[model samples]
Target: MPLLWKTSILLAISHDSNILPAHLQPLPSRGGHIRWNWIGDEHLNKTTDIIYMNASVAADGTLTGVSDFRATKFNGVTWLKTHAGREGVFAFKGPKAFMSIPGIVLPQDLKTFTFEASYAPQGAQNAELIRSGDFRIAWKGDTLSIQNGANTYQGSIPAVPAGQWVQLGCVVKEGIPSLFVNGKAVALLPGQSQPLTSIGNATLIGSGYTGMMDELRVWKEARPATRLGRDISPTWADRLLYFHLPADTKRSMGEDKASWASQIAWIRSRLRNPADHMVRLGIAGGAWKDMLRDPKARQKFAGEIASIVNRYKLDGVDLDFEWIEGPYKGDPPARQWDNYADLAQRIRKAQPDMCFTISLHVVCYRMPKKGIDAVDYFTFQNYGPSSARYPFDDFTRSLAAFRKQGFPDSKIMLSVPFQGTGDAKADSVRLYSDIVAQHPNLPPTADTAEFTYPDGTKRKMTFNGPATIRKKCEYAKAQKLRGIMYWDMGGDVRTDARKGQTDYRHPKALLPVINEILKGRR
Candidate 1:
């Protein structure tokens, strides 16, 4: 038997005076046999009309309906129903419907089910109107089949059609369930199955009935047909949980050289306890300059990073070096690139087991390919004016360009910005909260930068929200790309040159969302 989540009842009817009675009961605590009363009013009398009751149950049980006046008792250990009212009352009515409990003979377990009962259309009207317009059924797995009125049908999974009253049944036998329409086989499942147990709920019935259901039975047996009724896919929530880092930890450091060190500490703290998904520590841009300036400084930085690995520990290190001043600057000042390469090579040598990353700008025309090849992962900073205009195409082309330079997809990282900027003056150089407090004209979207082209045309660039980021991540995954990294972590903070004070705003805002996307859970 498979684990069951929850059971529900759906009733659709048109008549005004129709009353559907419901009886609620408790599920049995221990595994054992149980019994219940299956009684209903016998006043039902209508021609060419179908009537039935629907109930939710857990565990396997029998429902025996006894006609008191007629002294006729129909006992069904599986699933049962009728087309008209009772046998002989309506000759034009369809069959005396009784469906068997889907056999439970498979080897695996089942998870979900959908069932429905419906009324099939008659003649040209039936063909044009859509067959099985009204039907009712319940399932423990994917699909169900049922019959009602003058028509029979392959019922819809999860929901039956309106206007027809048909009893639908679904059961999980081992790992499969079979669906039957009007006692005839309709669908089968070789793998999917859901355990059928008792759900303490009343059975639904008649006229107002979207579709009639009565003498509905649930058993430990499997119904193969139900698995064909619907599709089952895993949800984002189902992937499991992973923590990136604390808000304060991610925010406390700014775009300064020390932010990388702080971030390393933060990542170590997060990795103290392992989770299902992997955790990453990103050292923002500008930090590389601090590491390269002095030999003593370089050693200290490396030592601290190694301590981070030894202490809280980490999966990898992300290199975000925005120090390259652009192509027009010519040759990139030589020593800067050398120092950058040295830092990367050292990190790789020290932590060969870790993922060594370097954040490089996306100017393929000007970027030094040799410097990029030193790191385990090279994240291209796809922000600024060049990226805003041709976002997707430009990024794809740039990735291709990197591959042409001998950089594999697994070695590349896509760095997108979460903050936006427009006018240098209007842009909040500080935290968002501080920006809000100081600059009254600044809008939530104003912080994003807007770039101006050589032709004097301007385009606005905003940080992508979770949805867009998720799509981008998916695209990257599909391309077999390495991973994603972002620009300066503290770009949202407000800085005051006069007082020399800084405030990190929205530090926790985007990191979690990014982590979620990377883990394929967003």
Candidate 2:
């Protein structure tokens, strides 16, 4: 009987070199050169001009990076079904396989830089984990080394165990670098501080290390050591890239995959109503405050946003502008508000067809009338605890206040809260979906949900159930308000629990309730 052997093999041959038969291979000649080639064509002409829409994009400035594999097909990385876990988390299994985030040119004027990701290694002792031009983070015999220009910083980190997840981070500030592992600082081999060379090539990950990575983030500001391992909030303004959630997998008008924009497209696809979707713009930090103070910066900012709106074929842009006045900026609150309105005017001038709107967070007196005129509509965020029922009196009073400020009833939108608050213990802020899943027999018209904790005590959470939602919609219609704006759709009893997935017609869902009341569809 003939001997049999079984194993898996990957083969690669040079296009310009000789091809050898599987059964026979030539031995290496003396002094012959050995070359390692990547699996994808490096010279492929691909455009990385497309912008990814994420929670960050909804609020912050323009960010350029690949949030999913679809954005990197130009560099030979395509979406594959074998990818496990949630969207945006990629699994790399081959040694020569790597993915590059295209069109990444490190801005030379950036004062600080930070890169971080959560990854699970797969026993590659010597492999490059991330590389961009001369900057590289690699593993050499279980030790991690970071290199930039002529400087190499090797940290005294423990042996990286193969199947466990580790949050790795590196921050470079004023030519000095710091390494963080799992939120703790690592002792580094000292070397002279040298400013990193600006990266002109694409940032590549998993060049040789076979692993799984998720929650990749990059920042133009070198985040302090305290915030190294903690997940950055979605609204952080300094963030250059935030690929943390499921919404990252899709584009604004991409026909290929699902995204926030795609979800809006999906809604319009099913409805006869000419619904328009606009990306929200706001920021959680001082970036916006500083930018608005300067006339030139504000103009450039508005133009960039208008360009994004045009490029993505979006309906328009919405301003969730908050934090206009703070002690950090000595300018009076009224002045900042004026600057904000001026920014709105600039944006409006750039794209006259854009449906400009704003989320009303300030008092009517502080809100600039000019800004109100520039916007097509405004959503009043009347947020408070609905201990047992929706605050009908407060809601009406807020609308009256806006009206006193010259806000038209037809241009005002009512805000609805889908998340539970007050009375519920342990998890006070529970999603409507979780509440519904806990009590199947609960009535959609009910205003409060009761839950029993492990301690045998029951607590009631007051949220806007279908009945409350319908009541608000009816009030909006009766008052001649523009429309109802749900605080968020993600917290509802979605047909699917994943982000960006919505089943608008679910009996207990708030959306269908609003539709029934406002659209007369019941």
Candidate 3:
């Protein structure tokens, strides 16, 4: 699993080939992985410098595939329990595990080429996961698509979620091939107009893989998704909190008991605050336009959010639909986005370990994508009206255009606005604690803030303070993304610097760098 970094163009071997390169040799696994096949697999010469490696050793040690490669044991692949400390391994029970790489060639000039990796699957078929000759890459069912001769790309592919650890990709020359989950490009598929001529002979990896896989590069050029490596979701590494509370847009919410004792004193001060990974605390509701297009109002809005989580024992709810992506305004288009994925599959059949989420919009439009993959997390509200500056390439090209439209930056998330949409021409949302309670010098550099209105018109405001929310939570924990959402907790309003305000608190400046880059994920 070696590739901590290195890819301006290429470099390979080491997702546990343990750095093989003396000519090559290492492949053996009946319970792990090793299907080998690259003996004369020509087609890797844009100034050739290949270093391929795919290791796995078990059935009684001593590597295996060495020359003109071709080994197989396939007990339906295995391995994947190591964490943070870094032991690069991943295999899946794919339809009887497979692999082959011989004569792999393709660059019949389709324009730009690319196909990075870090995948995770386990459902929906029309499988293949990877192939060479006809240049395939499957999952036609739950979506992660691509094909060659006579093309195959259905568009949006973000829900083939069997075990959920996406980072899959594709970038075939440009116009048509798009899908890329975790590193985020999300979906596009649709345009081939014909061009990619010579592609495979061999180069397959689990013809029907069910789950797990790691760092499988193959970039002829469009490369630029990077940020592989993920593993930390033991309920978000033990209690990654969520206090969203938006609902008060008027009624049917928490049906009252003084709003259920102020949401049980805001989930008991967010699990007794001072955050040592605050073990669970969700609520994020509002976006309730009569609970989207109706099926008995989405079964009475999932039975009033399952009776407010069995009447106040509440520990999770976040549906925040943010416009289920229908025809918008009062939504209705044939079941306003399939009745919110059938009300999150009946609220995951009534809270199967609740902690649901959904709040995307990086141009999602019609974005239901399997109803936010049936929940457990989803976010992307990537802010706006930042006067003029929020362009970190417009937030990484709207996260590579939401992974080209498939959406699965590992459960996805990136939202960014600690309040202050204010006067980017009267868009007005203001809440860097009321823009520092009337501009008392304000300038922690949210695109160089500014204020002067009352009609004197002199605006320019953004917001994110506290070192731009610790540099966007360290670029969403170095882009493995999946958690960093905060859209309106009253706009980061901790407020206390002697009332001159500006603390934008939200759990003391965003949970100490989101609990130090997610409890320090190795």
Candidate 4:
């Protein structure tokens, strides 16, 4: 429930018995009240296992929690009532609604435990998502920050438009704290041997939380990153159909709801392979953009991605952390790669079967073997203004360069754009289906095409037609690359008014060609 995108649905969906890890095999079903390991049972009354709210309120105003806890949603707080079939939903009225649990303060001798919850942020107004006086998670306008007494840190997670959700968890052992969001470990504060100072007041979910919450779990153990209750998800098979989505918060580009969420959902539910389930619908972009250079920022963003996949139940995650040195080159580029490696390592530990992927930007394309080791697959873009990977411009060079650099072609998915381009290597930039619609006479040869935008300006562009795509696919097969990929899901097709999504209009579009070439081959 904590958006454990690390989820397997825990059902016998696949016939392949050997694929699941030992922990994921067919198991007993336990309701929400399993007493995980309460070594402090003798001190039950002395112990402060208070439950403010376990992400849900029953029809009788009861919380589905463990023994020795009763969550009371005090002061006339209303439920969101739109839970999407989850375990719990708590809706707060800014500044008015707050839940508290008393006796959680540990005795001076205690030093280990876990705190976790699934929370969604719905606005910019200052409010605490969850906090004790000694530790707090809050949103100050567009940014999210955490505090432990006077020392505070902001998470690298990007700002979401009014209604986006994420999970947060923290494990404090001997006073050293490791924080997590959406199942990925984010930060480990310094001073492990010190005592965990208490919050003078009590454990509270107050200040300003304007969204639903669920699966509130706590454990009295020094749980390792691996045991962080990361729900497992299904795996992508040899054939991968991935989309690089921008975590576009504001829904820009004349779009409505988060780009392609509904579309991808449509694909997952509507389109299945008959043998396996549907495609392993994944997302990229957002949170990882500025994470390449800072340690805490990297940790914060790592959890952000994990949280997203968990919240959305994506099959996995794909990354595009582009800046190696970035503007001014102030940060060490090598360390940036290390941060990402840590991310993959931590998240994979929680959800080993989930597919993890990384993208290689052409200009500065180079990854340590370990970083590559962290992921299930590696993809390199061959299209851009550089005119390097585009078949219309010249397809041979980019693949050859990757080979020349000793890359494992078996792991590399040669990524291509599904749209046409112009300018000093790139421009006209319209969907492949749109290109066909505009010029019925446009041939499959690598020829220059003209595009007229709403501005009434025309630009000559080099387009990858059906013939070129087929050739590229054949070339990839001959070279034994992983597979061919388009830049995104929306770039190949035109928007459909009926479903408020896009439709595959032309059979000759490169997308169709890729699917055609890969059909039954894997």
Count clashing residue pairs per candidate. Answer: 69, 2, 27, 14
lDDT of 2 by residue, 49-68 (tens): 11112322212343222122
Point out where model 1 deviates above 4 Å.
Answer: 1-304, 311-316, 326-335, 364-374, 384-390, 423-461, 465-467, 486-520
Global Cα lDDT for candidate 4: 0.45
Q: CA shift at 196, candidate 3, in angstroms?
A: 23
lDDT tens digits by residue: candidate 4, 92-121: 667666666443322223356566656665
List the candidate 2 regions with Cα displacement exceeding 4 Å.
Answer: 1-99, 103-127, 133-135, 140-143, 148-151, 155-201, 206-241, 244-286, 323-328, 362-365, 385-389, 423-428, 449-460, 495-505
Evaluation by TM-score, superior candidate among 1 and 2: 2
List the candidates ranked by lDDT, beginning with the highest. 2, 4, 3, 1
TM-scores for all candidates: the values are 0.35, 0.62, 0.28, 0.48
Off by over 4 Å in 4: 1-264, 272-290, 307-312, 325-329, 386-388, 424-428, 493-507, 520-522
Q: Report the candidate with higher TM-score, 1 versus 3.
A: 1
lDDT head-to-head 2 vs 4, winner:
2
> Candidate 3, residues 225-255: lDDT per residue as tens digits?
5522232111112121111111122222211
Candidate 2, residue 99: lDDT? 65
In order, candidate lDDTs are 0.33, 0.51, 0.44, 0.45
